[model samples]
Target chain A: MPRSSTYEAVLDASLFTPAQLQPTAVGRLAFQAGTRWMRDHVCSHRTLVHEHRVGFVLWSWQLEYVHPLRFPDADDAVVEVTARIRGPRASQLEVEMTLEGPAGVAVRTRAASVPLRLSGDEALSGVPRPLPDALVAAFHDDEIERTAHRSQVRALRAGFERDGEQLAAAVSEFRVHRHHCEVADQWYWAETLGFAAGAREELVLKYGKAVPGLRRAQAEPIRRVDVTWLRAGQLWDLLQVRTTAHRLGEGLAFVHELGLADDEDGGPYAVVVERI
Target chain B: MIVKVRGVLLRFTDYENEIEVGGNTVRAGLAALTERYPNLGKVLLDRTGEVRPTHLIALNGERLTRSELDREATDDDRVDIVTAVSGG
Candidate 1:
């Protein structure tokens, strides 16, 4: 019963890497397809405006690169993407997306999101709302399979901590800014540090560093990413991000935690797990 | 006293647009507000009456924690509540 939608587009030069194709580019392409599907089927912009809701907030993302994609030098490649609303929770929706090219299936992704609704007089004043009845009924009744390898990675947590020091140090900092809060692109938590444009890149770079042999020496493509928004951070909030690496079979797993430097809670503002 | 509700917290309040609640301290102000709109309490505070971990409360632009709920509030002060949201 999952709702499905297809999005077709031509691979643009902007989505390609300077040298060779990269997994991040493929990931972004798949993410865009999922967003398009949400807009068309679940949380349409017209419905949101009519209902006075802010829009969907992506809580987590899991992507897998199945095949390498390259841009044709002469003619643009045709890309077809399909997105499925796999499940609905209390305040969350799970979307599974697939991107296919002329060669074959290129990438697959699963994302979780919450609907943010406006309140009071402020355009930005809003809170996350439970999934609508209509949207919930759009998916199957059974639980959707979890995309991220959370259990496997979690089991290795203690080992990661014990040998973390030997791994390359991965840390970075950024101050939240006004531009990071744009509604259409950033969404509600962008005012804090949930997710915004360019956040994925920052995570990728940090995770790549922590796991020495994980990233390609030359291209450094990312295979998968899982993120958790633990707390809300506001504009002007300074955040410190730290990452630790662990071995997951042939691939490497990285755990990145971000926290507000000024807050004493010691809890993370966000937690990101990257597998490469 | 003016108790301002920001973001999605407004959905639970009785006010259509603007909201103002009166109390002597952050805790009292929120309590009075929640008293008028019981649902607000459920969203803003936990079973133990503490602010939820993912939510933040600020008094006069200064962020506060559940332990600081007893901090003083005045008729002119502004209180803001914010919670975590997700986006791409």
Candidate 2:
């Protein structure tokens, strides 16, 4: 009755590590599955914006791995993904996703997103907007369950840099390359970090300086990553990625803020939070 | 005399979505479009009065580079503005 969608795919050999195991592959796959679900159910033919000025922004996401996914060279892992909308608020939407394999549940993800209205100048405002009636009715007709963690629905704020002081002094620079901005398969934003050449190296160099033990921690696996798109960059634009690292309980946390190289106060193009 | 709007460019046109211009080249067509919609110019062109680096202009399905904006166009030709959008 409700619009619960399922996606099926096989874990290719290329997705496996040298040990025949997939690390963080489940998370990446689950993210793709969620985007696919949104494209199919929420914004099928219409754009994400309702009245040209109002739209949705991904606020936060959390993925928990229940079991490691292993793709042996002899046998490929069959992956099944199911995603559904859980809570529909005046200005927020909650989604739950489950990833399963032969070993049963491999990962579960919960994501919270916010609806924003553009001001007269066509810039996103902090104020929330009402969800489109059509979208609301779609969820109601499906009888999607109410999210139990609605209490988690807090106003989305820029991470780490709630104040400018936190991000000062840590800067990494990059240039938007053609490969990163190429549109393929109707998806333009291909790379999560927004396609700069040597992105990994730039990130490592910046983060390595901010965090003392980052080089040593490379051997450890990343536990989680959250990305927020504040703005968009075009080709040939010089961008600077500013990073700040904090020491969490047992791991290192990083906040990377991306913006035009010439204008730091103009605002960020995107922000990435990674835990390793 | 027509400039086609595609992808996210439609958002800036208020969805009335059509523009009439008088110019034999892609540059002239965009200049006319921006004259009518100043906001569109802000999004489509950069401070240097050049097409924004992220946006691509195509004449009859043939993409033109920033320098090629001066390429010839006739009233019968179809000029489209293209920009890559995030799937989120």
Candidate 3:
């Protein structure tokens, strides 16, 4: 068993709130049960298909049977949900919704909503595009994002492909830092971006202000970039990234497969980064 | 216009917002536009007079392969950018 698992966050509604009791999008997108229920309903639409780039979050929800859907006297139904945030912007919101029904009985249940907001560099603040799945039946976290990456359904798609010891290295990297975002961020900067104290110095000597993270490349290419508010429940935040170097003529192209984390049962929650 | 380049660490704002870097000719104008955004000098042009990955170049009022814009810039051109970056 992988030492890092995100099982605790998916199964329990103890951290959920009551304000998310609406049937609207803010409620739906932020609640796991609502997200799942909504996806099941949206996918059946003949022309509707969801797409994702790098910033997408996923959710988990439980269906507590309510008589509202059955009888002629039921008033409402209850929903229970759990969610996991993916990417840099991470946070989980467990909530309950009262779905009005044909009967007078109000079925109240708990739900969870995972939000992956665009939180970083305060300069860039905006709502996320959209969650790829409304009701996720069965899809690997990487596969969920891959569904969009493999196919050019979205405007931006980054393919970071890696195999052999490299892929194994990434898997192990995630396992080691399974429970800690800080560790994962540090290692990613060290191993991936190669951030060092003087990293930007070299870039400054070369491109001056032309480069963003212009610092001394003491030992790494990555600068002090950090990840925040990530929520995978108890599921280990396993990012299945793929790295590849396709010649862009004289230039080079690097790809990454940033998959979201999942519970032991394997329900992917997000696609962190498919950046090139 | 200072637009966002997804993978790129930074951006270069000059000329028009749409696209003017793809036309078989845009070196002079692109260089001239650089005067307005001096911060982009090191990125848009190398000491040997070449475009660097520091900034993604597009033309023809559309988004095409980088090679299409990799050629020498003339007086006028076209270039469109969705968001280009080189990140690991």
Candidate 4:
């Protein structure tokens, strides 16, 4: 079953004027993945405006796992489309698309064709019909639940941020004890702390690592790092562990650091991280 | 001369500090320290016998930030091992 539904409509490039296509929250997120990717190669923001072309062509958006975004995007971006759909806009499209990313393999998505009806003033008369009320009702329910969950997250995060001082105060007292040798050299830094991994490969998966490394650099050694647990909950706050490697002739030498604040709001806490 | 890097120190979570090995120049000292404290060696080094990115090395009271450590250590050098770190 599809975890969610997203409707995409492509208009003839000439039919919709530039100013008229004010990106919608749905539209913005629908194409964010492509646009954000384009940002990497773009030299100027104006080019972003000039090259607003995204998966606008129906046939180019084919991928098993390139799904729409989970959050609402405020702006639109474009990225590498299929080679089949390159070059200037043609009179019509002749391609297929597939996308699935935000969620796992539990969802299905379908795209339907929508013809264009241009008026004298360059208006789009034909629009995608809204989903049925019953069908929409389920989506509404899903949206409600998702919104509620997000709202709770936002509320808790806001509360946490508000109490950052207090939380930091409370956080000072605990240290994370990383039991995994794969993690650190120490048996115990803080009697209490939260443990999270910070590897380059993992970091690259989440947020692409710095470009130079991905494109050409050889594999750098992993840094030794751990954190001090500050707060406890579904969400965790901690200090940082950093590792760096140096090469001496054919051998390698490594250095690492744990960053922690000893005091916050006049409270005492074991630095999940110690300042270098 | 062996250097020991530590992991993070927290209040609630479990585990202890890290004792990382460094200074290609001080391999013997680090090996001895690891022998004295087996737990430290196991936690800091990876499958490749290198320090895991999740921990840090501290020399005495000072934290190590040399992008590349001078693996060569003098016989008199003494370093402390600490924990992996977290937070902003």
**Candidate whose DockQ is highest:** 1
Question: What is residue A231's positional error in candidate 1, in angstroms?
Answer: 3.1
The sequence of per-residue lDDT tens digits that candidate 4 reaches over residues A149-218 is 0012233233333433210111111233334211212222222212211322232343334333321112
Rank ordering of all candidates by lDDT, starting from the highest = 1, 2, 3, 4
Candidate 2 wrongly placed segments (more than 4 Å):
A1-3, A16-28, A35-59, A70-89, A102-104, A113-129, A141-170, A182-190, A193-212, B1-88
What candidate 4 gets wrong by more than 4 Å, as runs, is A1-276, B1-24, B58-88
How well does each candidate superpose onto the true structure, as a TM-score?
A: 0.62, 0.55, 0.25, 0.24
B-chain TM-score, candidate 1:
0.83
CA lDDT for candidate 4: 0.28
Clashes of 2: 1
Q: List the residue pairs that clash in candidate 2.
A: A2-A142
Of all native A–B interface contacts, model 1 reproduces a fraction of: 0.13
Docking class of 3: incorrect
> For model 3, what is the alpha-carbon lDDT of residue A172?
14
Alpha-carbon shift of residue A146 in model 1 (angstroms): 13
In candidate 1, stretches whose alpha carbon ends up further than 4 angstroms from where it belongs are A1-3, A18-31, A49-54, A72-90, A134-166, A184-219, A232-234, A247-250, A264-266, B1-56, B59-83, B86-88
Give the per-residue lDDT of model 2 (tens digit) for A113-147.
55544332232222356566666665554444455
Tell me, per candidate, how large a share of the native contacts it keeps: 0.13, 0.01, 0.00, 0.03
DockQ of candidate 1? 0.14
User: lDDT for every model?
Assistant: 0.56, 0.56, 0.30, 0.28
Judged by whole-model lDDT over C-alpha atoms, candidate 2 comes out at: 0.56
The candidate that wins on TM-score is: 1
lDDT of 4 by residue, B1-75 (tens): 545333322221133223344444444555665565555555545565564554445544455653434455664
